[model samples]
Target: MRLAALLLCLALPVAAQSAAAPDDMARRAAAQLQQAAAGLERAGSARDRVAALTRTIRAYEAGLAAMREGLRRASARERTIRESFEVERLRLEQLIGALQSMHSSPEALLLLHPSGALGTARSGMVLSDVTPALHAEVEELRARLEELATLRALQDGAAQTLEEALRGVQEARTRLSQAISDRTELPRRVTEDPAQMRRLIESADTLEGFATSLASLPADPAAPDLPDFAAAKGDLELPVRGTVRRGFREPDAAGIRRPGLLVETAPGAVVTTPWPATIRYLGPLLDYGNVMILEPSGGYLLVFAGLDQVYGRAGDVLPAGSPIGLMPGADRAPAIPAAATEPGGQAPDETLYLELREGDAPVDPRQWFRLDED
Candidate 1:
């Protein structure tokens, strides 16, 4: 009996060790998962930014291409103008040659007075009538010459415009394609009915009012778990680097207060998320163009709108600074110098509207985004 009892005691320790092994492994696995989640968030943010820049760069390049095409059309018109002027020049030259031939050699035969006083009087009358006609011919020739000079200048201007468009194309294309390695991989956390969400979005009247309804929606459990949203506070980078055109809650021309921020950026300026979050909705809303909403935390939703084009859809897990979309430039805005565009390109006259909501209550984005005074 003692021998059997001793064996049982030994087996118990072995069993306990076996039981602890799985628990220890599970704890380690959980830790690794958290760490991987954080890493994914950062990588996603970087990729998102690249995507945004790519979108904007493409828009700028498209504009340059259109301008070049317009320039080509203008050049064709200038060529037509030059051809017409050439014909006018030849006609004027022929007239001058004929006039010179008639007047180049003057004979003293008339002054000889074969018939005396009557012949001299008739010659004087003939000279007076011919004088006015010569004056008219000279004036017509001078006007035709001036028209040719104007046409030449017009052609020169068109050439200059074309050359400028050509120069912009290479630079814009280079910046967009430089990062060939970076590609976006937006993970689908959960299957969402985009049509359903968009319908819900349309039903709401105001941004603040709509976001309140969105706050109640359940989060995707399968979403890659990332770090805390508040951890990025104060140190949060602006989604897109540009000049702040309007402050949050600032009154406009009619004295109506704006609840969000207006950032003026180059056409095709890349916009990224400021925190790890999931995209809840992406589509147009009222006067706001293409809109995207990111839920950074349980109750907070970040709103970005006035985009020329949008990226990703609902249920996408995005890391901080991930590219979501682009700020629009004027569809036909003139090209500004390189100085006008940052490492990016020239900003369009348009503005990106940014609003933050905590369960439907509007919060000043100025508090969230770092901005310059005034």
Candidate 2:
């Protein structure tokens, strides 16, 4: 019921915009112009951010459903191909043995040494019989070899996919330590009092107002503030391996927009920082659940929200790929039907929201890092 209700609340758009539809990437390109605006602007409201996060989760759940089915089909195909290869190999061996047998026979030896014109004529008759059978064997062997080659390729592809899935899981686990270590860290720049923030939020009408207020507050002096975070832009990587369900500044169904990338991942996936930064704020922020904002560089913030649980607090300095939290339902995903499917109709079960900021200005995250293999 939780899953169903959530899906109904946030209808996912198509995974990849079609040729007929407005190019999603084109919109992304246009959105980049937001950064080019005269000065820094504020982000959207909590409700708007939450709504986008909801849609991201719905899309992810759908992808997870499709991925599970694909893995099943791939596993079955792997078995079938392995079995077929064995069968064909035996047939090929038998064909080779038959040819070898014929080569050593009296009939074949006679062709090697014909007696005269009459003997040559007799040898010709034997050769004619042997040639047809040998040709048939060779043709069959050629076909079997071709089939084996195709099957081998399929097996290699399947192995790669399986390896990718395993790697994603392992990477998530590896980040567990960083998350645990930072759990006790204090808040930076923002007040630890939720009541105070709530009071401030009620008075503030816009996200910009709230963020500005948060910034005006005293910051933790010990939080590692990198002077040269600009150098780490292209070198950064994702916290988890997943598909880009949404790009930075992509508008939602209601036209409410945020500057962030939504990664559709599997349940129980790990979440980490793309680069080293101090945790500015780590707690629930109205609609954005379990938010963790990292300041990788001076004036450049990386925001990740919608986590099941967060392991760090404000003021802690984290390394790149530091494990911070995990998504829900790792044992198994909730039975939520995917709202939108991929090109091959696969859906995933989890969502992670990522956004970048240059001071107060929002920027396109697509320019930041390359994605891992699906």
Candidate 3:
């Protein structure tokens, strides 16, 4: 019983050393989760519940992402340990047999050697050296087994946490939609003329044409002044949590190319405004899904295509990090099991098409947004 307790005590440190990265990630994710929950509670009385809920939703996303990564790493480590054990199975068996024979042998027989006194003395010295090494191997094997058990426990616990995060994010999204509907606080940059907008939408045959026509519309003289959008180059955050699947002007599977980024995102993921901008247009256009056109400054248009739902109204001036829309897809399930099946949890649920234009001419968005390398 004492030996068993000692093995378990030693196993903890060994497990921590082996799985340090994953364990650290899990701890960070847990902290994020707590932050999200706290944000949700505080949003009930917050002056800007929309912004608070936005932060909550983002926290949930970040937490879920980190948790998924940790689980993936843990699963990989577990597989590696199992594989190592399989490769050393024969050697382990021999070691165990040797230990068992030493333990069960009669003391008199152990001392008695077939050879003379000199041979017996030499054998005793050899046994003294070999016994400690054999014991060390046994302890290591026990440690590995304990680590494997710890990993399994961690994975099991992660399922509940993932589920909680998913539900929390969904609740935050629903509340954000409600808050947006209830909101009448944001100032309009321009009072949109229905007839003029209809005429422009009907006449434009291409995105460039549409953008040029939209630019021709008069700006509100009383609109609030904002910081220069040009000065924000290389410092802008992406509107959503996603990976850039296609770079600017990069060809797609059909060999067609566009002067924009194609970002892959999870289903129902929240999309935000990367910077303060006036909504020039919102709704469906051409082959694109639901779209949003933003004007951060004169002669500049930031276009986001392929949203499932859009919030706010045309001409509404929104602040940076404002919830704009969501990517189309069903809610994610508790992803612990999925992490094992699909490590990294990066399966794309939808694609967001982003375009930037200056004077209706295309420019690479990568020059502006701070995209991390995959």
Best by TM-score: 3
Distance from true position, residue 191, model 3, in Å?
4.8
Question: On residues 135-194, what C-alpha lDDT tens digit does candidate 3 reach at each position?
Answer: 676688888898788887878788888787777888888999999999998978765689
What stretches of model 1 exceed 4 Å from their correct place?
1-184, 337-348
lDDT of each: 0.57, 0.54, 0.79
What TM-score against the true fold does each predicted structure earn? Answer: 0.50, 0.51, 0.88
Q: After superposition, how far is residue 260 of candidate 3 from its true place, in Å?
A: 1.1
lDDT of 1 by residue, 195-265 (tens): 85776677889766666677777767767776776665666666765668778888878887878888876
TM-score of 2: 0.51
Model 1: colliding residue pairs: 45-322, 48-322, 48-323, 49-323, 56-268, 266-347
Clashes of 2: 13
Q: Cα deviation of 134 in candidate 1 (Å)?
A: 56
Clash count (model 1, backbone only): 6
- Which wins on lDDT, candidate 1 or candidate 2? 1
lDDT of 1 at 47: 45
Over 231-314, each residue of candidate 2 has an lDDT whose tens digit, in order, gives 766666777656788877788778867778888877766676777777766766667677777777666777777787776655
